[model samples]
Target: MNERRTPAVAPAALDDIDRALINALQGDFPLAQRPFADVGARLGLAEEEVLARLQRLLDARVLTRFGPMFQIERIGGAFCLAAMSVPDATFDRVAAQVNDFPEVAHNYRRGHALNMWFVLATERPDGIADCARRIETATGLPVFLFPKEREYFVEMKLEA
Candidate 1:
C-alpha cells in the first residue's frame, strides 16, 4: 500500500545564470555585511538581481532549502535519524503532525517497512529521545532512533 506522491510543484527550468549562481553558491560564501552582493559580484550579477532570482527560485520550488549546514554536535546539540511505519491511509496527516515539531529538520518517504524517515535536531543531547517520545505520543506510533556511531564527510558538487 506504499504509494509515491508526486511533488506539489512542477520542476523548474534553469538558465545559464541560474546554473552559475548555483555553482557559485556551493563554494565558500562571503562572510560580510553584504554577502549577496559579494556572491553577485563573483557571478557578474547585480545584488538586486541575485536576490530576485534566488527568491523566484525558492518560490518556484527550484530549491527546497537554502541555508548553511550546521554541525549541531559541535555546539552541544544532537541529531538523530528516526523512522516510523506510517499507515498509508493516514500518511499525509502523520507527516503534517511530525513536521509541526520544530526539532524535525526534514522528513522523507521510502518504500519500506520503515517508510517515514526524518531527522530530529535538538539543542541538548538528551532531547533526541525526548522529541521521539513526544512524536510517538502525538502520532500514536513507535519511532526508531538511529544515533550516529561515526561520522564521514563527503563533498559533492553537480553541474546545473
Candidate 2:
C-alpha cells in the first residue's frame, strides 16, 4: 500500500553556516544537470560536501523537499494555497484530516481567522478543487482555495 511520508526528526538548530546556505539557496538555482555541483563551486564547498549538508538539513527538517516551481497550469498539473478556519478546540483533528490526503504537500498553523494553511500539489489541473471538496466533507470545515492567478519571477530574498 502507498502511504504518506512525514518528516520524522526534531529539527536541529542551525548554525551560522547553515543559515547562510539556506538564505543563499533561496535565490536562483542553476538549471544544469549537476546543479548542486555548480552551487557547491559558488559556495566554496565540494559537491559531496554540499550534498551531505543538504541531506542533513532535510533530515533535520530545516528544509522541506527541494524542487523547481513549474508553471503547473501550463503543464496540466495544479497547485493551490488552501486554508481552513479551524476552531482552536479541533485544530489538530482538522489538520490531521486534511493532511491525510496525499495531495496536501504541507500544512502549518497560522495566526488569522483562517488558521490552518497548506499547499496542495496534484497531478491533474482539477485535483485542487477535488481535494478541497474531499477535505471539506471529511473535516466539516470550509476549504478555501487560492489558485495562482499569475506567476512572478522575483529576486526578493528572505534572510534567515
Best by lDDT: 1
| Candidate 1 residue lDDT tens string, 38-146 | 9999989999999999998878867656888889899999999999999988889998888889999668889899999889999999999999999999999999999
Candidate 2 weakest lDDT stretch, 10 residues: 1-10
- Candidate 1, position 2, lDDT: 31
What is the TM-score of each predicted model, taking all chains together?
0.91, 0.76
Candidate 1: 10-residue stretch with minimal lDDT: 1-10
Residue 128, candidate 1: alpha-carbon lDDT: 96
Clashes of each: 0, 0
Clashing pairs in 1: none
